[model samples]
Target: PGVWDVAAKDNRGIMDVAVFRLSKKYPRANSVMTHNLPDGGHVRVASGPDGMASIWDYDIVLMGVSHLTEAMNRYRAGLGEKPGRSFRPHVSEILKFCRQSDGGRQYEAVEAALRRLKQTTVEIVRRQRGKDGRPLRVTEGAGLINDYKAVSHEDSGRVTSVEIELPKWLYAAVVEAEHPEVLTMHPNYFLMTPGLGRFVYRLARVAAGKGEARWSFRLIHERSGSPDAFKKSSAGIRELIKANELPEYDLAEEPGQDGPILVMRFRGSFPTPSTDTAGP
Candidate 1:
């Protein structure tokens, strides 16, 4: 287990094994990173290797998730063929499924996010014992899109549809029919503004599972890639608790010998939204 994507030793078996599987999957998602964070703003962890990442402030990552979810769901439910690196869908379809604001500006926003997805890249490393009883590092680059295409009208120059190339790693996760390893995102996920609420929600969804999940400030900060001072980071958690921003889960802070520990437990059964989750 020396090559685990996450350093399991850090948690000493306290963290759920499933949570560690979130590699850009966030419980099957990829990790995130880019800048420094502070007490008042997003905390950016200064330590760690290049692979550490946190949920992005913008919901664009969700946008990409929306696309990935669709094809994967279809494949899982036996609706569509297996997906290749490229996933193609229309602009309107992407909008409707995500329940996003519609208009020229909104369309433009999607376009911008698409650009970022193509550019953003994630490096994935997995571990397994080699034949010689040695651990191995399997590294692959997980870019959001390997290729992309947008069909636009000649006269208006408006994009009509889109085609995106998915990284191989993502395609494999979605196609893993044996364990059904897909992450189920909440319907209101897209509606959530990019901030502590969404951030906490993601961590809960990915790690909390169907029961109580515990994370220390250092662990969350490590995963969060937050740069805030320790006290400031704890304060940020308090703000989420008071606001009650997390959905389908309850947040509680307890006094630990070191400091306060954050625990997230299932509020009850998570209710799936009745919104349109399919392409139009």
Candidate 2:
């Protein structure tokens, strides 16, 4: 009986045909002719106090082997094989077959592969665009409606009022752009400002509906504080506009809830305030 326990323990550890044969040959002195013995091929041997059986059956062994083989196959599939680039073409073929023969799995697989291909292609194109500058068209204009100005007394700084003329098209664009903060400062007069090269660039973007352009300008200033400085600058802007024949607009100054702000009047309607403006 003691040897039976030892044999059971050995069988539990080794779990082999050789160990079973050894246990059967070396029977213990007190061993009863128990049916529940490992040596008896048909009997299920009781190993512990809980009466748990230590049965080494063919079916269990076969199942374990199957599971191990499956695991190895999965590992090899993941690491050993490289995914083929022809996957998309293959998937497309399968999808065609599915459409013709009504195979659901093939159709689904093809759809998924096509989606993945599209995403990958978009990413590649985006990367290429980032490396290169965005393809955009640029338009240049000499003069554009920037700001309004009037003559001011050198002593009192009171504005000697003057009316400004704005182009219809320029007015429409400015109104559409919605710049209002430009008028809030309430300078005495509408200043003839330089052609806004940068503003023109942004406007070009709006016009083209893609990419961006940059504008640069050179300005002539008589004196820093002279009220006439704006008036003089206006002449240059006017000349540029006239030479370019660019459509211009009027930026009307009005009182806002916060303070004075410029409004763009295009056609009959006054649009929203512009975000782009110079100065406080």
Give the number of the best model, judged by TM-score.
Answer: 1
Q: Which stretches of candidate 1 lie over 4 Å from their true place?
A: 1-80, 126-128, 154-157, 273-280
The alpha-carbon lDDT assigned to residue 62 of candidate 2 equals 17
Angstrom error of the Cα, residue 169, model 2: value is 6.1
Least lDDT summed over 10 consecutive residues: which range in candidate 2? 2-11
Cα TM-score per model: 0.69, 0.14
Give one digit per residue, the lDDT tens place, for model 2 in 70-153: 222334456334221111123223222222333545344333322222221100011122336775332222111122233445
What is the Cα-based lDDT of residue 207 in candidate 2? 27
Model 2 TM-score (2 dp): 0.14
In the range 28-136, model 1's lDDT, one tens digit per residue, is 1234453222322221121123232233312333444444555555666788776555655667656665566556666665565566555556453445678999977
Per-candidate Cα RMSD to the true structure, in Å, reads 10.2, 45.1
